[model samples]
Target: MQQKIAVLGPGSWGTALAKSLVENGHDVRLWSHKEEPVQEINNKHTNEAYLKGIELPKELKATSNMAEAVADVDAVLFVVPTKAIRSVAKQLVAVLETKPVIIHASKGFEQETHKRISEILEEEIPSEKRQNVVVLSGPSHAEELAVRDITTVTAACEDLEQAKYVQDLFMNDYFRIYTNTDVLGVETGAALKNIIALGSGAIHGLGFGDNAKAALMTRGLAEISRLGVAMGADPLTFIGLSGVGDLIVTCTSVHSRNWRAGDLLGKGHNLDEILENMGMIVEGVSTTKAAYELAQDLNVDMPITETIYNVIYKGQDVKEAVRQLMLREGRSE
Candidate 1:
């Protein structure tokens, strides 16, 4: 069966997913707040600014009008940034006319509220307007997905059937989807891994070998699981795709903005300089603060997260911060 889907946000990930939907024979309309990319995607069948050199399918259309893009769609996907999600959800409910399956591919908690993405959706979108929100997340990167790389991800919702529905919508030969009922675990894992990715990139930038990164990632997963379990998430979900899988890919991939940002920081560049140069959102930078705060509130001992927070926010020297981390009291693994 064909579905009419509206993808809100024309960033690299959003554009890539929209392109995939087009190839899957769906009536896909991508909503972009900016008219420049809208015009470019509709006219040239390309989003050069985001997915450079990739030609989007002619069937994939884009619109600046949010209401028009989602007018009669079967599903509406929010692919915008974390900072913009609440605003976008507010805008969606204002124009949404039917009960559509609401989905979000964006990761990271709201820095102010420390709320997960679905929590924000639930707060903003009335239950009368939609079913439960679904989260699509994993190690998949937009750059690779745009070029049809083999990618796997998880679609999580409290309702198993809803997750299966999404799994069917996205699964293809090159793109695989798994369903999980652990929304809390999946969302937390997806957002928290970015912090570790930053740590791994800093390790790489400091000229450390693979052994150090492996240790950071391994310990980072332990920290993530600790906080996650404290917040009532399934312990086993930490080893699943949205958890360890996301951590591995983001920490090591060249396509990770968080890793790139951390690399620059490790090389002595400030956050302002790195952000200006990257021209993309490094989610981990903000997530580090949010996770750090959450950890403090939960009384969870996350040493690596604490160290990264001090280095990034307190302007502590990266090497000195690392030295302090190394000198901390050893604990049983």
Candidate 2:
């Protein structure tokens, strides 16, 4: 059965997902806040600014008008950045008429409030205007998925039926979707892994070998699990696709913006310069600040996260930060 889906935000990930839905035989309306991308996506069947050289599905439509994109859609998938989710949700509720299932692929906590994307949606989108809120996450990347490279992700909602519906909507020959009930774990793993990816990239930038990167990732997972479990997430979900899987891919892959940004930092570039150079959102930078605060508030022991926070925020030398981490009091693993 075909469904009318609206994908908000036309960045690399959003455009790729919209194209995938169009190929899956569904009516997809991709919304962009900027008119340039909208015109490019609709007129040229390409989003050259973001996807660069990748052609989009001809059937996919792009709009700058929020209402126009979401009108009569069976589901509205928010693919905007974490900071924009609340503002976008406010705009959505103002225009949304149908009680479509709300899904979000964006990962990160609200900077000021530390709320999840689903929580922001729940508070902004009136209950009468939507069904269960679902979070779609995993190790997948936009660049790879845009080119039809095999990818898999998790669709998590407390409501099993809603999760299965999203699974069916996105599953294809190259893209596979799994259902999980641990929304807390899925969201936590999705947001926190970017920080680790940044650290991994920094390790590479500093000319460290595989052993160093491996240690950072292994201990990074421990920190992520500690914070997540303290917040009431299922411990098992940390090892699943959104957890260990996302950590490996984002930390190791060159395609990750967070990793790339961290790599620049590791090579001795300043945070502002690295972000300006990337010309895209480096989620881990903001995530590091937010996670640091959250860990402090929750009294969770996250040495790696604390170290990265010092490098990015406290102006500590990256090499010195790594040294401090190595010198920490050792405990049995």
Candidate 3:
């Protein structure tokens, strides 16, 4: 069934998803806060800053007005940064007249409260104006998916029916979606993997061999699983697409902002300088702080995350942090 969908973000991921939905025959209205991108998307059918060298579907519409985007839409996909969720949700509430399936694709937690993206959404959007909220996440990158790369992601919601509904809405020959009922597991995995990716890039920057990178990825999953389970996520979810799958891709791919930022850090650049150069949000930097605090509160043993936190926030040397990680007491695998 063809439906009207509003994609609430004009970043690479948001534009890629909107393009996919248009290809799937859905009427897509991509919302952007900036008028330049909105005009570029509607008039030129391109988001040059976010998705360069990629042509968007001409049928995809865009607007700066949130009311026009959410009005009469069957679903609204929130694709903004983690910090922006509350503000966007509050604006959404003012205009949303009827309930629509709320799907969020962004990953990360609220730095202040340490709440997941889904939790933030539920807290902001009233129950009467929203149906079940779903999370779409995995290893897929916007650059690859924009070019029609075969990608698989998980649609997670507590309600299986809602997950399946989202699965049907996004599934295509190039883009495949699976349904999972473990929303916490999926969301936790999605948020935490970025920290690991940061570590992975640091390993590469420090001139570490493949063995070191492999070790980082492996042990990173262990700590990620530990924190996830402590937060009520299923252990098995870590091995799924949103867990280890997302970790591997984000850590290894040059397209990942977190990995790229970490790479600059490893090459001896400061956080402020790296952020200035990257010109995008590297979620892991913020996520590292949130996960570090959460792990401490939960009494979870996340040495990797702790070390990364110190390196990023405490001004510790990256090489020194790696040495400390290696010198820690060994535990059984």
What Cα-based lDDT does every candidate model obtain? Answer: 0.93, 0.93, 0.93
TM-score, candidate 1, is 0.99
Q: Each prediction's TM-score against the native?
A: 0.99, 0.99, 0.99
| Candidate 1 Cα errors over 4 Å, as ranges | none
Instruction: In candidate 1, list every pair of residues with a backbone clash.
Output: none
In candidate 3, stretches whose alpha carbon ends up further than 4 angstroms from where it belongs are: none
**lDDT string, candidate 3, 238-330, tens digits:** 999999899989989999999888888898988898988887788999999999999989999999999999999899999999999999987
- The digit string of per-residue lDDT tens for model 1 on 94-197 reads 99998999999999999979999999999999999998899999999999999999999999999999999888888888899999999999999999999999
For model 2, residues 1-333, the per-residue Cα lDDT tens digits are 999999999988898888889999999999989999989888999998779899888899999999999999999999999999999999998888889999999999999799988999999998899999999999988999999999999999999999999999999999999999999999999999999999999999999989999999999999999999999999999999999999999999999999998888889988888888786788898999999999999999999999999999999999999998999987999
In angstroms, give how far residue 92 of model 3 lies from its true place: 0.4
What would you estimate as the lDDT of candidate 3? 0.93
Our tally of clashes for model 3 stands at 0
Look at candidate 3 and tell me the lDDT of residue 221. 95
lDDT of 1: 0.93
